[model samples]
Target: MNTLSYGLLSLLSFAPLSGYDLTQKIKPLWQAGHSQIYPLLASMEQQGYISYKLIEQTDKPDKKEYTITEAGLAQLRQWVEMPAEHPVLRDELHFKLYSLWLSEPQKAKELLYQRMEFCQSELDRYNEMLGGNETLREERGESHEPKATTFGRYMLIRKRIMDMESSLQFCKYALEELEI
Candidate 1:
């Protein structure tokens, strides 16, 4: 299945959420906007992957709360069991990198520096969220030590942050090498 379907199913698996919350979360994680999420949600509903109920909060207007259906859960199970596909890296930054030579070298250098800064900022944020002594379990007042499976997931996220930091360092070195 596509990322959108997998994302929707994953979010619903955690807890029922409104389309708006889903959209907001997707923006940061998947780089998707509402235009993409709303249509996909409609399509998933049509395909019987999910169902929604109108929820009226005491403090707010009625909202559609989405939950995964049986089919969706089954699909999620299959997805988890299946071998992961080789991830195809689609880097928008790379596109900009290649096109940079068309303009002044200084301009290209400036852009790359800006991108490195952005990556550094994101790495810092992820580190704050997932790294160090303070953790999700700690924040929730649960056991300081998490289950092995949860710890594994946490390590994976940490690895991703490290990978981003590595990429940022590479960009910094490349910029210096380019003398831009």
Candidate 2:
């Protein structure tokens, strides 16, 4: 299944949610466009992978909340067991680092410092996300269930936090190594 479809299923596996709610839930990891989601929702519904119910609002337009079908659950379960594609990190900063050998000592030090600052901010954001997950897990009565995506989300965010810490260390070490 496509990433969007699989992503939709992963979220729906938790609870039924409006598209707007889903977008907010997914914003941290998914940079999906607003235009991309609505059409995909319709397509997933048409494919019998999902379905939506309309909820009436007193002073607002109706909301379409989507949920995964049994078929979708089966697909998700199978997909989870399959080996995932290797992740591709398209980081501009990493590209810049690749050419650090060619940059002047002063320029390289400046770039490394800038990267460290960015990593720290990102680390803080990921830590905040981790705290948010703790609140969510507490509310949901979360357990270490292998089947639950909450566990996966928590792990992924933790990995990012660790990655940021490593990145910061690497930058500091590079500065020292070059005596810059």
Candidate 3:
């Protein structure tokens, strides 16, 4: 299965989610759209990895809420045990920074400022997610001790929060460099 396929499965493992929900939830980690996701979901369903129930909404169109099958969970677990591929770096800001010498000082400063704002926005989002997780845990009467269901999410969000903070610091440093 492709990475996106596995990503869908991973999300389903947490809880059943509609196609729209899946598309929204996966955005922070993977770039996928309904065009790519629906087909994969269909293929996985055919392969007996996932199943969906169609729910009729009074206000909106009917939607399929997907859940991972046992086969899917087993595959997900196996995939987890396997070594992960190296992450691909595709940030356009890196290219902009590489060519910054050719750009105007004000333009460079604007780019860094935009990046700083983006980093702060992402930091706030991740912090909110972490808070939501904490609330969910407390509501369930679960202790802070790492549990199978949430440990990965908790750690991943924490790491992303750290990354965003570091990125903001780097932006500030670059802005200072541009000033000098």
Candidate 4:
């Protein structure tokens, strides 16, 4: 199985989710779509790594919610214990930034502005998600340390928030250097 296959299993270990749900949840962490996810789900099911239950819906087509099996859990545990490969970032913005010296000052300023906007939007989305998590915890009278089931998600969102904030600051500094 590929890395995405393992990613799907990791998500299922958190909770049973439909293919659509999995796609949305994995978007921030992995670049995957329904086109890729459905086939992998099918293959994992055949390999006895996962199983699904048909979920009936009143207004929409039925869906299959997938869950990880014991075998998948074992595989996921082993994978986690193994050293991970270095992360790969495929952002087009990086290429643009690398060649930024070739651009006019105004053009470079525009690039930084665009990146700032993108970072702000992502930061806002992550902040909203974090707010929702906090609200849910308060409603349940839970502690700051999230339950095991949600600990990974909580920490991941916080990390993304910090990343976006740092990006925005970088953009600001770049703009200042350009005297924008």
Best by TM-score: 3
Instruction: Output the better candidate (1/2) by TM-score.
Output: 2
Instruction: Look at candidate 4 and tell me the lDDT of residue 171.
Output: 90
Please give the lDDT score for candidate 2.
0.85
Worst 10 residues of 1 by lDDT: 140-149
What is the per-residue lDDT of model 2 for residues 1-180, given as tens digits with 9 covering 90 to 100?
588778888899989999999889778677787788888889889989899999999999999999999988998889888998898787887888788789998998999899899999999999888786665576435565654556777777879899999999999998998793
lDDT of 1 by residue, 129-154 (tens): 77564545454344435443345346
Model 3 reaches what TM-score against the true structure? 0.92
Q: What Cα-based lDDT does every candidate model obtain?
A: 0.77, 0.85, 0.90, 0.88
Q: Summing lDDT over every window of 10 consecutive residues in candidate 4, give the lowest-scoring window.
A: 135-144
TM-scores of all predicted structures:
0.76, 0.80, 0.92, 0.88
Which pairs clash inside model 1? none
Which has the higher lDDT value, candidate number 1 or candidate number 3? 3
Question: What are the per-model C-alpha RMSD values against the true structure?
Answer: 3.8, 3.0, 2.0, 2.5
Query: Which portions of model 4 miss their true places by more than 4 Å?
Result: 135-147
Query: If ranked by TM-score, best first, what sequence of candidates would result?
Result: 3, 4, 2, 1
What stretches of model 2 exceed 4 Å from their correct place? 58-60, 101-107, 132-149, 178-180
Hey, what RMSD does candidate 1 come out at?
A: 3.8
- Candidate 2 is scored at a TM of 0.80
The residue-level lDDT of candidate 2 at 71 comes to 87
